[model samples]
Target: MEVIAIQKSTLEGMKNELKELLELTENATQKYAPIFKEEKWLDNQEVCLMMNITKRTLQTYKDKGLLPYSRLNRKNYYKLSDVQALLKAGQPYKSNEDGVIDQ
Candidate 1:
């Protein structure tokens, strides 16, 4: 291995700069900490129950791009915020010939 030497003053300056950079990063992280809070996730069953919809309907929503989800371990997970936003959007349902609302 080749031996390289850095001046003591240069090393000290590098350390100081690194320390300052770390402090700035930490401060920025803390400043926006609330925005990065852990997101609440809901599984398929929970989402269906909360939205009062069937699993097939939930699948339909996903297919229609009305709701976004992540699948892991062969299970689907959804963001609570996205579900709430869909609810707030008040997506209308279709009516059947018998005057029954079809969701």
Candidate 2:
């Protein structure tokens, strides 16, 4: 009877430990699910559409070192954030309400 009681207690302890481990794994997945979302790189054609410019003009910026991009497997790919930064930098702002004075 004593040995049986000890074996039962040991089994209960292992069950409790496994339950705790499963709960911890569930919590971690809930916390980091978004971080694992798929990311698709935007290409030059898509970037030109987003930036509202002609392909020739965008190519000029790429050649001039004003924009940063990556060439992947013989094709150009731009991070959307980096493209947004380039567009923001190139935007013509009406400084002092003078309306796009070429300073």
TM-score of each: 0.55, 0.48
lDDT of 1 by residue, 51-98 (tens): 777676777788889999987699888989999998899754533556
| Clash total of candidate 2 | 0
Q: Please state every model's RMSD to the true fold in angstroms.
A: 8.6, 13.8
Clashing pairs in 2: none
Candidate 2 least-lDDT 10 residues: 93-102
Instruction: State the C-alpha lDDT per candidate.
Output: 0.82, 0.71
Candidate number achieving the greatest lDDT relative to the actual structure: 1
lDDT of 1: 0.82
lDDT of 2 by residue, 1-103 (tens): 3544468789999999999999999999998676445445689899878876666656766777766778858998877777788777873321233332232
Q: In terms of TM-score, how similar is model 2 to the real structure?
A: 0.48
